[model samples]
Target: MNDISMRVRPGTATALIGRNGSGKSTLLSILAGLVRLSSGVLTTGRPGLTTGYAPEAFPALKLTAEDYLRGMGRIAGLCEAAGRSRVSELLATFGLDSFRSRKLAGFSKGMLQKVNLIQSLLIRPQLLLLDEPMSGLDLPAQHTLLDLLQELKREGTALVFSVHEPQIIEAMADDLYVLQEGQMLRTIHGAENLRSAPAVYIVYTELHPVAQQAVKAVPGVRTMQPAPDLSGISCTGLTVDQKMSDTCLQQILAAGGSIVSVKPLGGLGDLTEWMDPKDQIGSGRG
Candidate 1:
């Protein structure tokens, strides 16, 4: 974790991406105050800031899911009534209401993971840290959790989670920090724009109407629209199938359009290459 500097803004989701043993868990622990930083400053927007942390694994306890959550809520300083209400609400929200009285020892991996997430979300902390949040779940359950997290983010909770799945990163993360051997390798902003498309490239340039039409006429161009504030035109195209990027570039250049920047949107392949070469692209865990 040396020379690491990053910010998790309110209402934004930040993702920690890395291979196994890359200190993702350690960094989350530090942020959650479960582990202390050996050096460097950690500043929060306010004192006594509430933070929730959900680790990758949940212990199998003999207690019922509801009872366990109630105990945790009490430990978090919620009153008995509040604890009961929140526990019930979260259990039902995660589609575990019917199994609230079931012992955690008998629960399946996906059910336990739901309990793990519910516990961290009990107090509705300003900042929530989750490690491998989507480790064990079906597609529907995953979508349910994502929707809940998005609702929390809308209410101004800062989310920081370690993840490997490219779909999760595209669906939730506003910014992504890639870690390798405990070092910050890259910080990618606007991570939400990443799509599952084969390959999408964003081109920034100032172009007249004629040039815009010319660029749009390129075989692979998907869209050509004016940039926000009308500074220039932004062109998006698909590039992987026939390697049409070169042709697109040539078209823009031939139209006398000055290129500002051209970059490909991060996709499954890009994320896999960024995290680790040996691992599969959508394994859903780090």
Candidate 2:
């Protein structure tokens, strides 16, 4: 992403958001120094910066979760005893204690995801970079990870995560950068003022005739549009009044359709406001 310039301050969380192939990953890799820029200056300390990265895909390895994390801690320059202690803490904190000796190959996607997250935290990074950090986790795992992130933020660790999860951004980020074609199209700040999108849910079930008819009767709900990835029948992407979300869920269950995703697209109201040219961030829209 060329011509993109932004600053992530200490003790703040920044979210880099954009559609697929909009250069979010590349930009993130560059910032993490995994990829080098052809030109332009990246100011850093003479000794180089430290970071923690959790990519979307877990690494291919046969090591057990505990062993792998301990190895990572040592690689991060921690002493053997310290590394082991840290590994124990991280594993227990993420609820991988029972699976401590289990090899990663035998682990489920969510379990592997937990390990992936653990390795990144081996170092108390000054800046943490997480790419789609919630991709392969269930609700409980996601909550655990987010809670850890919140704890880190309180300790003054700077965070920059690339995510499609608007909820994560609204709850954790101090600023959000919208990337388009490798450049930042807009920047939205003010976490306190940013309104979380009110409870948007995406239901994914085979549409039955009875269910379809019954869903239309749900107050404040319109027909769900197919999402871009064809991942599910999205009941989200539109405004959903918070009070009616529970009733809508009940109606979907009654209709015999199973749920695929119940996403809380927070910060959506902020996005809508940003979409308006009159909004402060909208003034810089491309």
Candidate 3:
């Protein structure tokens, strides 16, 4: 990492990518002011600048989420009323309101990670540093983090996060620093390599076993899920490629499918899976 030079401006996101033990975490800690730099000039945000950090591991805690968040809010210099309001909004945003009274001891790893992230954003600092924040998350949780990060980016919050998932880096980063052997090997600008976002469309239609199977023949269909009540299934899971959408619609109509509705699919991979009984069949569920 000798003689490494870098710059991250506001209204942008910078991603640090590296293999494990490549000192990505160490560099991130340095950026957060937790690691002392050995030498060389290292410039960062202004003095007295507020920073939000979400570490890889949620620290072992005995407090309930409510108490922990409130305490952190206070630590962030948030007044009681502001802290309470922010906490309530975040709990609902992450679908954790019902578990507000529960202790960290009772939380799943994903829930704990969400709490960690919520606390990080509680202050709305000038800089946000996250280390492997998506490591333990399921697909849905990963999508949640993605959405939140996008929101932060849009708000012009400078982000410097380390992640192994190229998809996330591609999606959120304005600049990427590829590191190896504690050295910056290469730098890639996100806009240069960025591709068009997936043109996902939510296609709701009447259910017919034959039509359902027929629509599966569509070239760009990602998932064909049966709707509840057995009335109609949704093509909501598919990533609608705009170029192929017209062809897909024609194929669906040919398959005797009647459109109930059509809309764009947004955040999360497929949250409908939560309603699936299979979700509770995992090790913890059993």
Top candidate on TM-score is 1
Residue pairs clashing, model 2: 197-267
Q: Give the higher-TM-score candidate: 1 or 3.
A: 1
lDDT of 1 by residue, 35-151 (tens): 888899999978888889999878999999999999999999999999999999989888999999999999999999999999999998899999999989878889988998999
Task: Please give the lDDT score at residue 243 for candidate 2.
Answer: 61
Lowest summed lDDT across 10 adjacent residues in model 1 is found at 233-242
**lDDT against true structure, model 2:** 0.74
lDDT for each residue of candidate 3 in 1-286, tens digit (9 for 90 to 100): 4657788777688887655555577777888888777887777657777889998878748898989999999999999999999999999888889999889988888899989989999987778999888877789878888898888888878899887666776678788776655778766675544334445564556546776666667776766665443343443334565556677677767766665555544332222232122322212210
Model 1 misplaced regions, further than 4 Å: 191-216, 221-243, 246-268, 275-286
Q: What is the lDDT of residue 7 in candidate 2?
A: 83
**Candidate 3 lDDT (Cα, whole model)?**
0.72
**TM value for model 2:** 0.69
Q: Candidate 1, clashing residue pairs? A: none
**TM-score list, all predictions:** 0.76, 0.69, 0.66
From the highest TM-score down, the ranking of the candidates is 1, 2, 3
